[model samples]
Target: MSDTAQAAPPDAGAPPRTGHWKLIGPGIVAAATGVGAGDLVATLIAGSRFGYALLWAAVVGCIVKIALAEGSARYHLATGSTILDGWRSLGRWTSWYFGIYILIWGFVYGATAMSATALPLAALFPFLPLWAWAMIAGLVSAAFVALNRYEVFETVMKLLIGVMFVIVVAVAIMVLPNVGAALRGLIPTVPAGSAIYTLGLIGGVGGTITMAAYGYWVNAKGWRSPAWMGIMRLDNRVAYAVTGIFVVAMLIIGAELLYTAQIALTEGDRGLLDLREVLADRFGPTVATIFLVGFFATAMSSILGVWQGVSLLFADFVRNIRGGTESREELTTSPAFRFYLFWLTIPPMALLAFGRPFGLVVVYGALGAFFMPFLAITLIWLLNSSRVPKEWRNGWLSNTLLGGAALLFIVLSIAEIARLITG
Candidate 1:
């Protein structure tokens, strides 16, 4: 064969292929982080309350994620800047909002992630008290982030994802309902007693502040052009689809296994731990063990991901604010980056000592509810304007989806605020 024939076809007369799978990075990491413990609990509650009637919300969540992830990736590909840079182009106000948001969000989320990880460890091995296990969880995640390079971080996360994938998806398959009912979930009708949780599940489906980190992941993967956009979309789609499946599986467990069982799982992550005992009772110890392992994988991955990913964001934020002419590469590797990483891991340990403040949890949720809408609205403005090249700007479809996400997020945010205030 000629050299040209052997080299594989080029994309739009650009460089020849090395392969596609090698390009998958940010989408996987962002999607993984977005589907954290809180998200899982949302799906579980939806399942327990309404069975598969609200499954459409989970599907809607997947769509919202794709829109948000694509918007972030689009900014990077079009403008050759981080979303932070894009925000800077808009004005200092954008940067200020993110700065305040990250500071408050990180403090509260650190404690929440640590506690979620600790709950399972305390369950799996009662040798340690919950607070001690929580502290250990924080330290272990800190070590994982501090010790590993990006490639190693990605590998470990993929492994954790695999554990979650096999167990949760397998359980879903094992308890497969009639195909008709599952397919009917796609029609988008709200079931009785499902208005709030349905909205919650839709909002929860793979949504998180980590969605902003998708652009950075793309930068890490070396996908930096309009040419790679198709593959980028595919990557986001596949990642979030897998995320949706895991969520739906948890919902199925709630619906099929726990709904009518007369057991009231506790609030927050303690509820998930309680659900494990319910699993043990209903499906035997092996299934319960599977639940525990899956829970730990979900929690630990979220911790490691937030520890590394948000630290990168924080480093960039600080560098941008400091304005000392640092490059992205240097910003990520700088002392400042490591400092924020340490900050994310350590100071929250104070919360572990005193027990988490209920006020902070409500603030976290209330503040968190606004993030998706914030990201969505910002991307619509950034990616659509002169900040990016015309070739890489969001097409009509991307805009429509993002606009829909913004609207959905607004409604969800109001609902969340009402719940927080009322509770």
Candidate 2:
């Protein structure tokens, strides 16, 4: 029991780890990326159209995301592999499917993201054309990604997240009405014309292809072991916890303010610009301007995160498929990574020149429809197998939650496809 008998010291080669607040990396990025322009528009459209009847859908969406994101993080911490590599171990076809999915997703998403970011900018600075503002957003996102390290990127995103919750939620609080009806939304019933929006909200809550990037952020932050699982859970919870509050605030604004006024919010990101008009009428131009600023922050944060995070995933995909697994140094320093990063930034700007990229836009929505189910199904496979150590794999409860997410997203996707096909 002597000090000398206190045993050999911990291994010098062991990895360093983060604790508590510093464990905040991936969760913040994932949350910021998830609550983009599409989410805002969807919630506002629901509010303007259906009042508070679909409020439960937004809350449910947030919960589903928490489960899905935690699964991604668990897979990373348990197996020490990116989801791309995890998919590859399942089969070569898995990699090919992801490659095609991401390629199409990114091309369309870049244009959509740029346009969303530009709406606020154009509103604020009318001198610049919308396309000009769009280019600036794309370039600004590219510059930030090119120059900043992961820590810097995360810090900036955290700040934008702070601004969004403060301004947007504060506005919602200022606008809440009919506490009785707002509470009734918790009953989980869908009104007429609300079924599609309800499913979209449920499936869209804080999700995107970037959810898979949770692991890279974990690795970037050095959160590398099973002991860190509790911390990972807390991080994911707090992230979507903030996201849930944000969506609820949007719903309140929609139901209390927009429904009462009988104002219709347009579909897509322009709906946020539309909200500016509604806010101006109710609360004055100052509040309207504040909302625009928040909208800009939301759009910009997602663009920057995708510019950096997804490009990393793309780079890894290339590395895995081409049999360069041993080249970690090259993977980080490779031309493939830079190429995808450029691809994410550049081509979509051309859409600004020839009007909006309608085809890209359509594909973005379709890709989005299937993404949550894809993530849920893949996480179920990855975490419930020998790929992850038995001790760290999903428990029955986790599997059940993920399975529910899969079903929910599948239903949502079917509805979306029907809308597209019929339209």
Candidate 3:
């Protein structure tokens, strides 16, 4: 890429950029961050229990995410503002809400992300306890993000994603998914008692609060004007295309192996551990070992993803809240960014030793539910308002999809709340 291709706006107040792709980075980072072991477990559980019954739901999730990402990317390209800037323009309340939410979200997610990354390693080695592995994982992720720029960050992310893709796809092929059943799954039907699982498959399709970080990634990639729109779109599409394939492959493994065998795995990352045993039984120790490595890749990718992306988010939040101009370089090196990165990596390790406090888990779960609808409703509001330029605004199709996403998230959020309440 030339200096011209990778340049930021000549003036901060310049018009929309008319640029195209010489490189694709942020989209891969976003997709990898969005799908952790939790996502894989959810898809696998859905597949094993439901047997491709929610394939369309997973597809719907990919579509919803694409819409959210595009709207976010467009806002940055059109306005040269971070999502925080856009939100701040909406009201001071947006800043307060995000500032509070990011603090709470990062603290809780830090522990979970670290633990997820540690699980496969613990299982593989069996020498160190899970908590010890978790501590090491957090330290490694923090040190890297604290030192690297977006270029190195992106390179490492793509490499992790490549490893993830190969291992999962190989597992899927080994399973030999039922072609007719999978095709039927594409038609979209809810079997008895599977409504919530179906909704989860659809709504959980590779998303998180990190969706807002799409613009940060875009800016980090040096795409600031609408001119880079073509490259942005291409990058975004490729990201989700890869995400959808990974989800489907996990589903195939679930349906073919677990469903047929009438065995149900435990939930969360431990579920993948159970999967390793099954793979060892069916294939061999070597294949299961490879699968476990892929599992680590998925979990660690998420840890690094949030380590880089959300830290950027926090740094930007500090810049805006302080009423100071924030250059990308300044933001990357800013104390606030490194502080959050340290916060994400170091403090959470305590949770591994002491165990996550019960009171903390409840608060974490509630706030987690709060984010998806928050992102969806906020996007619909931001893109449709005079805030965005007419040319870059949402079309009817985009609005319809976003509107549907808001509704879907609303429904799902309600379900999560109810589950929390009743249980």
**lDDT per model vs. reference:** 0.78, 0.80, 0.85
Q: Candidate 3 lDDT, tens digit per residue, 229-255?
A: 777888898899899999999999999
lDDT string for model 2 (58-118, tens) is 8888888888888888887787677788889989888877888889888777887899889
Off by over 4 Å in 3: 1-22
Instruction: Locate the minimum summed-lDDT window of 10 residues in model 2.
Output: 3-12
Candidate 3 clashing pairs? 17-225, 17-226, 17-227, 18-227, 19-227, 19-228
Residue 121 lDDT in candidate 3: 94
Give me the candidate number with maximum TM-score: 3
Cα shift from native, residue 363, model 1 (Å):
4.0
Model 3 weakest 10-residue run by lDDT: 6-15
Instruction: Put the candidates in lDDT order, highest first.
Output: 3, 2, 1
- Cα shift from native, residue 398, model 2 (Å): 1.0
- Give candidate 2's whole-model lDDT: 0.80
Q: Give the CA lDDT, 0 to 100, for residue 35 in model 2.
A: 86
**Model 2 TM-score (2 dp):** 0.92
